[model samples]
Target chain A: MSNLAGWGHYPIVATECLPERGPVDIAGLVSAHPSMIARGHGRAYGDAAIGQPFTLPTLGLNRLRSFDAATGLLRVEAGVSIAEVLATFVPRGYFLAVVPGTKFVTVGGAIAADVHGKNHHRDGGFADSVEAFRLVTPGAETVTCSRTVNKELFAATTGGMGLTGVIVEATLRLRAIETGWLKQQTHIAADLDAAIAALEATAASTYSVAWIDCLARGNALGRSLIYAAEHASAQEFELLSNGRTAFPPARSARLAPPLVAPSWLLNRASVGAFNALYFGRGVARAGAPELVHWDTYFFPLDAIGHWNRIYGRRGFVQHQCVIPLETARGVLAEILDRVARRGSVSFLAVLKQLGPSHGLMSFPMRGYTLAMDFPMTDTLLPFLDEIDALVADAGGRLYLAKDARQSRATFEAGYPGLAAFRELRCHTGADRHFASHLSARLGI
Target chain B: MSDQKTVLILGGSSDIGYATALRYAEGGWRVWLAARDLASAQRNADDVTARSGQPVTVHALDVLQSEKFVDFVAQMPALPDTVISVIGELGDQKRAETDSSYAAMIMRTNFEAPSQLLDIFAGRFQARGTGTIVGVSSVAGDRGRGSNYFYGAAKAGFSQYLSGLRNRMSLAGKVRVVTVKPGFVRTRMTAHLKLPASLTVTPDRVASDIYGAAEENGREVIYVAKRFWLVMTIICLLPEPLFKRLKL
Candidate 1:
């Protein structure tokens, strides 16, 4: 037995973690353990990937089964990470149709969370790019799920929090690109309303995201820097690379912080000062349309390895929710105000626009999503409850991938499809075999 | 096709074996991965081929079955340019001291089986007049201690065999033998132990060191982290009276 935690490092649990090096015998494992949950890279920021007694880590099952160059379709084992895919195919002029903020996450985790990216408004969630997947069911039978085969399972498994089964392999559609570069345009928004307007205006771009200053108050409340980008063509890349048209070479991380930061080091004042400098730098370079590598444009935080250590040993919780478009602007402003009033320091805050959801329990919808990270501290859990009530009233739903604590009532209120999902689980006998901390907490 | 190099890894399912296969594949060599578990070897072979865009084949070879060694060599598609044996078992020392069967299994896994397999490859290489052989040994072989002398003794015997092979191959002036002594590698075999972080290195580090040694001629023996050489030198030269008195 060993202690394990999600990426947030909060709610650490002591469990028997089975690391497999070959094709997993899911049926055997399920029959042997009282209860278990399948985990991939443990990238989910909360309890969604942890179990009470058993956690099956699929990092060892990584392998690429096949690839079709003519059709740009690739089949890979669930343990294959987005970073691995990028490393192998980027120079070959292909990219994943959807990629989350970090490339460190595995394909299985992305499918389980139905992760969305900066291109969500244009490309939809990860389910849009997935064509099929092989799942080892609770009954120990391997079944292929897709639009035409095991259709119901396909709908429920994506974004089902790994309750449906253990995903083993997936076939994904890859987007062809001329070069691994993006032409990015930055827009500086002085306040909450301006930020929303900028995101709405650039809805046509292939990718768009905003970095907000959560501590800024009054007239500067919700001040943000919005980045809109499109894939750079070969000619555009050549113009920037001294007539060279080759893809960007992979580079190692520049910095890896210590294992843990001192508890007293990340208070409100220190975080506020860092935000001020970051916002100022963004404002200074707001106008020019620059050609930047994909790594710099999409995964800026990845450059600092183990960045979660900045939140200290107690770890942190990320509060991410999406409100309907009709009430997004008002709800966003209220959320920013409530956070500022509480004087809780959130070091990183992100805002993005999403298109319609693809899976039964997918997080994305036609609305605006806001994500903020708060270091674990006394008086923070109750404060988050207040925010949860506000979101429920606005008919908004919290992202399970980022949730560590939330009332069962709040979860049911947001997901109207919960009853259908539960019914399927009961029919498949998944309710008795597959489980996680998040599943138990939400009474799924 | 003639210009492409080929390598055969004997324990391809092991962490160090898989990593070395990937390193050689990245260097544009066709890799043959052999393991007792055919399923695991195939998976690793597919992964190496996918990641490096190089061809990889899988074969089954159970080192414990000494009688099958001849047939296993004959079945290979061709004699590879290099053959690396990374097969060993770190059996429980306490159990081995009391159980003769367990102690004998450890001895055969670490010393006898590997030596027999390498002897076959060495004979073929000698006849071919040009080949490289790498044997992965452990730093524990430098000295025996009360904590794990069973595994250490087997490894020490294996290291001696490799040194003798190197001496014999040098006279031929065609075949090369390299011995690798890894101090503390963070692999599944050592996952249960709480090793000091400063002394432990990743399997990838050992894989690259092996690749570098095979590519450069006349590089006979090396330590994975290089620092282990100095550390082992002191341990090997220590006075036996004082060494036996201190607990490792």
Candidate 2:
């Protein structure tokens, strides 16, 4: 509600008390009310976590009742945040092996979305880390699913959009960390080709990613800075001064003027000028020694706070596509060239090196992932249609989480395992009512 | 168009209402852009679908046509998860002097018909324990002004109704109630009005913000340009005697 930004502000039904503190009978409450959506952390940008009738904020379900430090096993309530897990367990020399960009996400939400991170090429998604979970379905039946028991439900719940059941608690594996530092090397590529070359050459390392300048065109269409890291030992951390709170803390909750600018203000001319300044400001930047802290290295966007407002009132869409390694160079070059020609103003564009897919419903493959922000506008639909065709032609697909305006037709056309997902939804036979609340346009 | 989520817009083709249709279509949501006039709503639907490359269906959903509402609700392939009422008229305070009819129409447009539709949906929402409802009020409802108290009164009444609806739905599961109180919006409705830089908000910005809020339940009663919140704060803090005398 800050400024005149046109955002939908629904009345959040406040459950000031925890689920345990409240009724203590989840089945009774759900049976009495069928339209409830189990929400975790309120982090989902769209409606996957929200349904038509209710949003069940499950972040409050957090409780770490059991942890077997010897086995590297922990059973936690679905609401417990990943940060809390690390805070409690890291001192015991354990952490989530596979984590997304932000530590603010809850374990349940992470599992439901099957979220991945920069280390995805090495570790895969959160589902890979989990062992078992207690699931409560719409029929008010609670079932514990694991690799052995209810195996189909276990796989279905992973990236299942919370349609099948509600997660109460789960057991997951944790990795041992030393000195909380990454033995890292940074390579600065002068142009797109060099960046691609650098990543391709070094992605075999335990940890690897590339941040490319998406606005760069022509000879520099894919200029990038690459980082490959390994878990640092105490000696390496000491040698490089790599451990603990290294970066200057960013200012959070800094109030910016929330004024609505005329539509002309964000048109191509102004955006082009901004792009010119941004693209010109950088050429090739290099190494920053052994990096530390999970926060700074991964979730840089989370540091900025409500960063989406930077696109102003019309908000922005994050479009990500991954083209296979065989076509990565061509697809990336063409995409950047088109963006430059269109004078697209995206302050943040991320490029990551991906590896082969793990299984069914997996988003990653041995390819290059390029993510760029585009201001939501009247022209965006057609513009994206052009981009989608190009990505499709290049054997690439879009990410579902960040999507706002894609048709189900487009999604089915793009994503490889979409048919399998549809069949799963069919077999589940639950009244499919997933809220995108973003736009009623998706044919879901 | 026929496959669209049927929306029964009471006012139908009002600027903000039509703008909402565009927002719906842009997101690939098939829209039933209902208006008082079937032709006007259909035309607006055509315009929105053509522009957004999404589907739009038109329906006659006149507040005056209350008897049709039940049949309308039952006829839908599914009960809509959302309903938006963007009906308002900044009735001149001077008109209240000569005619109660104009004032009543403004009141009913701003408050009554919306309340009736909401009463129906609220029951459905409570019965189902889910659904979202949106009522577009104005910053005019924040504090009554000497300039437009007649219209402001209606909006204020509508705002309170939404607040009550929100309270009722709070325990009724996830029946979301959104009360939009935008400030100076640059739509056809305000074509002739003078607006401050901080007050004016674009249709696209409004649509996107509203879409984001609805998508995420970020806020209720979102002021289009967040600056309006501060502006309203300053206005709210003004001394009573001094505020009443202002030409503004």
Candidate 3:
């Protein structure tokens, strides 16, 4: 037995972690344990990947089954992380169609969360690039799911929070890239409305995301640096690489922060100062279009290993919610105001526009999503509950992958697809065998 | 045929073997993964191939079956530039202490089988006039401990065999032999043991040490994480009476 927690390190649970090796007999394991959840890299920010009793760590199952260079399709075991994929295929001119902020997350976790990238507004969620996946059902039968085969199960499993079954393998359709470089154009926004407008205006770009200053107040409230990027052409890469077109040198060495930061290190005052300096830098470099490495553009935080430790031993909770386009501007402003008023410290704040998602329980919709992390404290949950009420009133939903604490009522209010999802789980007996802290907390 | 360097890894299904295969593959070597479990070896081979964009061939060779050693070497596509033997059995010390059959199995697996297999490869490489051989031993082999002396004794024999092999290969000055002593590796084999954070190193760390040894000539022995060399030195120099008093 080992103590485990999601990426956020909040709500750590003691569970028997069975680190699976090679090919796993899913049926045998399922029958052996009363209940278990599949945990892949534990990159989900909250309790989605953790549960009581047993946690089947899929790290050992990592293997690339096959790759079709001609079609740019790769089949790999669920534990295969995006970092591994990038390391393997980027040099071959292939890249994942959709990638989350961190490349350390496993393909299984990506599908389970129905993760979206900065390109979500243009390319949709990770499910969009998924061709098919092999799921080990709660009944222990391995079933292949695709849009056409096991269609309903496929819909429910993607973004289903791993409750539908254990995703053992997946076939993903990768995009061909000329070079692993992005022509990024940064636009500095003065306030909430301007930031939203900038993101909306850059909708044509293949990728767009904004880093907001959560501590900014009054006229500068929601001030952000919006980055809009498109894959750099071969010619552009040649100019940068002295006529040699190659993927940016394999991921640079990452610096690991101390195991845990003191709780008071990241207080509101410190975060406010950091945000001010960052916003100033963004303003200075605003409008300059530079060819940056994919890692720099998409996964900046990944450069700092164990970055979560900066949040302190108390850990942190990420409140990520998406509001419909119509009410996004107002809700975003109100959220920024509430967070600022509370004087809570959030070191990282990101906002991205999302296109319509297909998965039954997918978090993305045709809306604007704001994600901010707050240090977990006695008052944090109750404070977030109030934010949830506000979001619920505006027909907004919180992302299950990032949710550590939220009232079941608020969850039900946001996800209307819950009824269909629960019905399928009931029919498949997944609800009984496959359960997680997130599922039980949300009463799904 | 391309002049790509080739490496054959015995016990390819083991975590250290698989990691070494990947490390060699990534360094532009065509990897051959041979193990008793062909299915598991093939799966790992596929992963290495995919990751390195190099073709990895898988073969079945049960180390305990000494009769098949000659056939296993002959069956390979070509003589490899390097051969890494990562085969070892960490049999339960308590069980082996009483059961002669179990104790003999541990002894044969950790020492006799691997040494015999390498001896065959050494003869082949001698004829070809170029090759590198790596044997993965352990820090436990430096000195016997009551807790796991049965398994440790076998590894100690294996380590001595590697030392003797290195001396023989040095006479020819064409072939190189490396013995790797990894301390507290965080592998499935040691998952049950509560290893110290400072001492425990990942299989990848051990793999890199093997790679370094193979690439550099005259590197007869290496301790993974490097600090294990100093650690084992002190442990070996300890006064027996005092060393025996403390439970390791």
Clashes of each: 0, 30, 0
Tens digit of per-residue lDDT, candidate 1, span A248-327: 86556899886798878887899989998998888888898888788888888889999999889999999999998999
Off by over 4 Å in 3: A1-3, A240-246, A250-256, B239-246
Query: Regarding DockQ, does 2 or 3 come out ahead?
Result: 3
Per-model TM values vs. the true structure = 0.93, 0.57, 0.95
The DockQ figures for the candidates are: 0.50, 0.01, 0.69
lDDT of 2 at B56: 66
In the range B1-248, model 1's lDDT, one tens digit per residue, is 57899999999988898899999998889999989988777777877876777878999988889999989999999999999998988889999999999999988888888889998999999999999999998998889989888889989999999999999998976999999998899887887799988888999998999999988545789898778899889988999999999888
User: After superposition, which runs of candidate 2 have C-alpha atoms over 4 Å from their true positions?
Assistant: A1-25, A242-285, A357-360, A432-444, B1-248
- For each candidate, give the TM-score of chain B: 0.97, 0.89, 0.96
Considering the two chains of model 3, state its CAPRI-style docking category.
medium
- What ranges in model 1 sit over 4 Å off? A1-4, A12-22, A242-245, A262-264, B98-102, B245-248
Best by DockQ: 3
Better of 1 and 3 by DockQ: 3
Reference contacts reproduced by model 2: 0.00
